[model samples]
Target: MDIEIAFGQPRPWTETVAWGPYRARHADLFEFVMPGVARYTLEDRSRVTVTPEDGADEAPIGEMLVATVLPSLIWARGDVVLHASAIARPGQNAGLMFVGASGSGKSSRLQRAVGRNARVIADDSARVYLQDGELLASGLPGGMFIRTHDAADSRTLVSVPPEQQLKALPVTSMLILGNDDSPVRRLTGVEALASLLRHRHRPRILRLLGTEADFIGPLGDIAARLRIAVVGVRAWMP
Candidate 1:
């Protein structure tokens, strides 16, 4: 099946990505040569392709392919895509997402939650959209990378062979990470809207969509229906 994904910018590649039993519509971003295989050509005349070893499972490469493709799709669909880690309950009763810049421990906290048996919704980046009367957090294409103070100790946690781990999960709450020693807290109404807009992937999109005028209203509605918060985790014991 050929899945055509539209994008805001012209696709850099003129080729199609072929995977096992499936072919993906490629634009300029990147392309996958097979299941779990990816090729990215940089302007510096360098190309990087992620391919699985012989007889190895192709799921990881497949995931990389989706990660490369899904964000653009979500952006084109007019939904917000943010860099964050998210978790949801098994029955989907409520969910939470953490967003931040690199080294903010977004993935670390997510991995920690896995130890606590919290069902991971997504890692690295998540796509949020509204369906029916509720804002649903859904899993996107990318995987999470675990970083630990001790490289050796990281292995004990979500160990995927070959020393690299990647898994897909669902997203529920929208939590922006900021440095603080205060306890975790939920945000609602104007506070929630402010938090979301502050961390939104593309603020210009809001203006473009003409949703800027009512952005706070929609975000407040979503926050009320779902769980949203800003969490502060300390590096040292309290």
Candidate 2:
């Protein structure tokens, strides 16, 4: 769906970006207006409106559009959002999602896979859901966001098509990346559920907005349907 993001006159409010009650106005309604980023209004469960920060260039607006606004949009659609990177084998339609905490090498590992002929699916955020008993991964239009320093070594990430977003890649497996040197290990249902919940993205706005009730059921279903495993560098060793 094409979302229209029209610039609006600034709302007269304190300017702050801290993730706290005071920094955000209309907290009770789950709406946020970041000073130098963008303003987000969760109109309802399925609709959101965004206005770019005043005087911002295309890059910042685009960044916030993907990192902040897009996730909110995906959440509104009732899909389980993940703080992870995903990749698919070359010429294949299915992919595996690799999730981990910040600094856990999720993106780096996925880039390594890209060097070995895997296609970059989603770099940092993914919208995953079960469709007709098959798990799938969906991404937005922006290319993978590679740190400036890592650009020298990134293969597919070096030149991602801005308009090319993976519509859907059936998810055949899930991996939890870590720093450990151990080989891959399958996680039990309970473990996978806990891991999924831990890495899933739900903005702080969901707190006072009282939308957790809508997500609990779908998350449980995702955990039950997908097989999850924990892996480390060894799993990617040649």
Candidate 3:
């Protein structure tokens, strides 16, 4: 339940960090390496062990936690975590979520949603779970998808998390945001499953941990009840 930071004494990686970012080990333990930050090990889906790179700043470590580490832990615990964003509007009963792969415009749409004064349930890596047969989403502590042009690169995003702890909000609709000409359409059955599977956070680790197949039933229920659609990037408030 705590992050143990280690220096000098590094955990051995079977493969080089550059070539191997993720290693599929025993179901109880998982270890991964990320450049420009630190090496991370998820212990039994409960605790985190971090090995910072030489002179690595704590800022990058915090960013990587929200980016991958935290979500990996949540995903390992059997929750349906997606590299997606969620937003809720006033007087609305259910929140809306946007899901897509990297560079699919999910973040841009999220920035726009926040600009519209919509309440942010989560930014990237929306942690979803079932509560009494109802699907709900809870944002990670530092949940906000914001890219700073002044930063090192175009992919560098700074997250300003909420001031207080966030609560899980019911989700009734999900949209796959894309720039393509794909008409706005509802996805169901195999289509929904396939789309959702593609955007799962750290799917390789989940598959290695033998929990990927466990999502079929839960995802089916989520897709069947919720309005999962594919919306073009130009279309908003869809």
Candidate 4:
């Protein structure tokens, strides 16, 4: 585990963004306060404290920990995390990834592939890194958060039973989902990295943490080597 979580008392902090139950700030330290739920304080984005609110349930808090807090820690650890989804071919260590704006069918296409026997790698975010000059991805801890009804029929749709998480897999291909006029098209290195940057998780936070250089270094390296392409119903074909 790259991050450690523990129960602790909530500390007072300035509000950065207050919307509904979520109040957040990132000054000396990053903190998220969920009224009547949980207050999370990430110390240097390394150690996380989960302070449960009165009468709060564990499921939602756990979800936030896995979905939001962990991703922040991943970035703090100098890794590149993206708002993407992926799946690996069954019985193989290699994986294929799909990236695009929300509602661009990243999840939908991945679900289609999952129905055809691809193992779920990630649902909404992909934790990526470079290992021995190869790009790799690991499943984030959580079930595949599906927004469409068709995904309900996927074989892997069992609500991420706590023990059924996947391990890291070598990412062999990437697809930039869009409504291009071609079926599929290869992306130049510049185009590929641009797409990656647009999907980077907490890109703004990376800059505030002064880690943008670290994040882009590996991203460029990965983009330079991967078989990147753009795919749509009429997308550019490689």
In lDDT terms, which candidate is top? 3
Off by over 4 Å in 3: 1-19, 149-165
Estimate, for each residue in 34-148, the C-alpha lDDT of model 4 and write its tens digit: 6777888777656888999888988778767766777767776777888877777667778877787766666556656556666777877788887887788886634676665
Residue 138 local lDDT, model 4 = 81
Clashing pairs in 3: none
Q: What would the TM-scores of all predictions be?
A: 0.54, 0.78, 0.83, 0.78
lDDT of 3 at 69: 81
Error of 4 at 222 (Å): 1.4
Per-model lDDT: 0.51, 0.65, 0.71, 0.70
Per-prediction count of colliding residue pairs?
11, 0, 0, 9
Question: What is the overall TM-score of model 4 with all chains considered together?
Answer: 0.78
lDDT of 1 by residue, 11-93 (tens): 34443444333233422233323433443221111223343445645555445445444543344344565566667543454
Relative to the unseen true structure, what is the C-alpha lDDT of residue 204 in candidate 4, on a scale of 0 to 100?
59
Which of candidates 1 and 4 reaches a greater lDDT? 4
lDDT score, residue 208, model 1? 32
Provide C-alpha RMSD values for all models, in order: 9.9, 4.6, 3.6, 4.7
Instruction: lDDT for model 1, please.
Output: 0.51
Residue 89 CA error for candidate 2 (Å)?
0.8
Give the Cα-based TM-score of candidate 2 against the true structure.
0.78
lDDT for model 2, on a 0 to 1 scale?
0.65
Q: In model 3, what is the error at residue 28, expressed in angstroms? A: 2.0
